[model samples]
Target: MMRHLLPLLALLAAPAFAKPDADTRAWLARTAELSSDAMEGRDAGSPGHARAIDLVERWFKDARLQPAGEDGSFRQTVPLHEVAVTSAEMRVVAPDGSAVPLKFLHDITPRPATDLPATLGGAMRFAGYCSAKEIGAEAGPALQGKIAVCFGSRRTGRANGAERLAAVTAAGAIALLTIDDVGFLVEPPRWPDAYARSVAHDGVTLPSGLPQFRVNGAALATLIAGSGRLAAAILTDAGLHRDLESFDLPGRFEAKLTTSQRKFTSQQLIGLLPGTDPAKAGEYLLLGAHIDGYGFGEPVNGDALYNGTLDDAAYVALISQLAARRKGKGFARPLLFAAWTAEEKGLLGARWWLQHPTVPKDQLAGVINLDQLRPLFPLKALTLHGLGQNTLADTAKAVAEGLKIGIRPDLEPERNLIRRVDSWPFMEAGIPAVNFIFAFNPRSQEERLYRDWYVRRYHRPQDDMTTPMDLDAAQDFNRFFYLLVETAAHAPETPRLSPKPGT
Candidate 1:
């Protein structure tokens, strides 16, 4: 009687496979609020941020995932500093007794908001795109003891736009700011300066200094007008291929700034899916996404919240749903499900986790990072974002083709999407991680249809689940993801990471 009951209990206790429904849509829909302007971009340590974390925790519980963080609590406390720039008093002084006062938070907002006694009468240095120019002996002018004013653009399409801001700040520049150089008819809803940046690994390192901050459009515009030579230094037919070396905006301007800032602690949400195969249970597979987004930046369509709708809220739902489905099903290894914190603060959460994982490096298998939900084009084919590096790329291809899904190779690697998602840490550690994405391209008539539809409702205040969500598509992709995981796990031995390109 005891043996018979054991089998029945085991069968009944199995996890439920995720099902797509209005309920699932509703579950995902809540994230928009967390990303909404009211939440102020969900910066790591804000009250609104805590609210988002709470919602994610509730979802994990509802999905039946065992607490993957400390002491049966799904929260892994990651101490972080929440830098808030309460106010700034900055201005420009001309040759004459003319005086112009600049808005502090409006003119500049840094990575770590500062709280100095609201005054920095530093000399002003005019830096053009912050590039080193090649010309006569005096071309490479040095910037010291002065605030360096440079364009926000740096390293092209591969880096987070915040980086150039961060770099200059690190170089001892007292103040930092940027302006729009690209042309996008429909600017980002709230995060006007946001890089639709899908790849790259930055600090994710524990932040050590104040995030030298600056304001968006309004302040930047004021500076440009004062800059005078702004047009020739930045807006010429420089051609995309030629480097803008030596293009310095030569002039002397007096700059000063004053502000108040605050800092706080942030945390990472983590959990685990113990594998069924005992022999390989020690090895691991990781899934992750940054849980924080731009709480607020520029205003969009009369709305000021930079809710990262698809920026990453979609990934949190995707992971929660996937974890609930795969837990104890048939995985043979420990699969770590991580919801990183303060990613926008320079990969604060993920960088920290990579260096301090629960398992050792040798025990790691691979990683899968989800950044946003690609509701457009619906994956007519599986296009591996990073296709040149390893065997995992081939494995992804085989899985997609075996499943009869078309395999469209990465069309433009110049975009360098390989490092775009949170998968960079795993991939950098040689763990063969891959990013699964559904992207929108407006250049093509065919692609534009989806691009227009998806981008229009993608990240704004209007990014709720009420409009045009296709459950069938979501379910289909989830199914594909499930099978891919199964194939990797059920392999006779750990899948080899020595995979070459074109496999």
Candidate 2:
């Protein structure tokens, strides 16, 4: 009898095939439509993004969601200013009076400064990781009038990006050159960027730091040729966070930089799904996903369009599908569906919405952000960003367990991925919020797929719809998210922030 029941139980479990169900099919169809080349990668403030907005507004209307944006409209305009580098040229002036021209995007990609100079030149000085401790007391005199080259990798015990900047700036460096770390297999460096650009909220002041650049790993050899240090050894040591000595390279770093500036406006789509119970209707839960991608840039394998199929377009479609499924029904608390813009430029869209909320900020009970989720493999587990930091974790775990999916806190905290997504703004505002990443076992094929996606497709034109996807995995995650939202929205008590230390 027990053996017979075991077989029956297996039949009742969710299928593990690669085919998608009707619901997943619809969600994927929407994703394909939004991430197609016709959408021009949906860059924020671009015509492509405008079309995306129109499509989403229609979806919201069809789903019976109420207009909950500015002045009762389903759209909230966000003003933004953009700066793009039009031309860049760098050359190495070797001590022996030889000049070698470095390819712009191939050899190095410079971060365009707000107050960019037409030309920059300085002697080359390497300061290992450029950490405060490594720079030492004489850093000021050592790096002055030189271009400080540092290892670019954020590690557990090393000084972070901001600290490195302060240290180098205080040392009077004319500019900074950071060799991109190659050992971070999770997200390796991919050279030949589409373009260098920056976007900021309109009327906001942009930082005027020293002009900085990322040197391609292959180009490191050229930068350190006469320093008597092997580029491979330097990168190997840097990857392990080992201490390295500082030295001046036998070259003068020179560059010519040119940029174009423009100002434009983007809009965030906001809609409200009303609740059935009047008592809990006053409280709200927000579900958000960014709908922007890198519009166009330098071509890769002859494709210049950066179709962000999974980066976020797929998740945006997921939220739309959720709204459509709950079209005629209601949870206890109202649900806010947000299609954020300019997420690629920073968390500008979400940040702006937080600053100018459509509903009372205090009424927002919790948030579930959908981004950085990759269903390349079976959805056996999930990595929750704010797992132990909020009360939402319990609800999320309960829902996930019902679907047989394991829930765990971030396993890669060194990446600081938790604070990099849109939910962070809500978390900062004392609201319970959570974001997710599909988990994979160490040394498993699933891990390979996950890491490969980050290396080959992430933030690249190769992230188009042609990439293979595990439809079953996608469907499982979809179901899990839908149930999670339903559980949170119907809970008798609203989710609250966990108590902070000393509180």
* TM-scores for the candidates: 0.72, 0.95
Clashes of 2: 1
User: Which TM-score value belongs to model 2?
Assistant: 0.95
Tens-digit lDDT string for candidate 2 (227-280): 888999988888887887788899888999998888899998999998888999
Error at 100, model 1, angstroms: 5.6
Off by over 4 Å in 1: 1-42, 89-130, 135-137, 141-180, 183-233, 239-263, 296-298, 326-328, 404-417, 439-442, 445-472, 499-503
Q: Which stretches of candidate 2 lie over 4 Å from their true place?
A: 1-19, 501-503
- Please report, as a residue range, the 10-residue window in candidate 2 with the lowest summed lDDT: 3-12
Residue-level lDDT of model 1, residues 278-360, one tens digit each, is 88876677778778876654455665555666667767767777766654454766677788887766566777767666556
* CA error at residue 218 for candidate 1, angstroms: 8.8
- Candidate lDDT scores, in order, read 0.55, 0.85
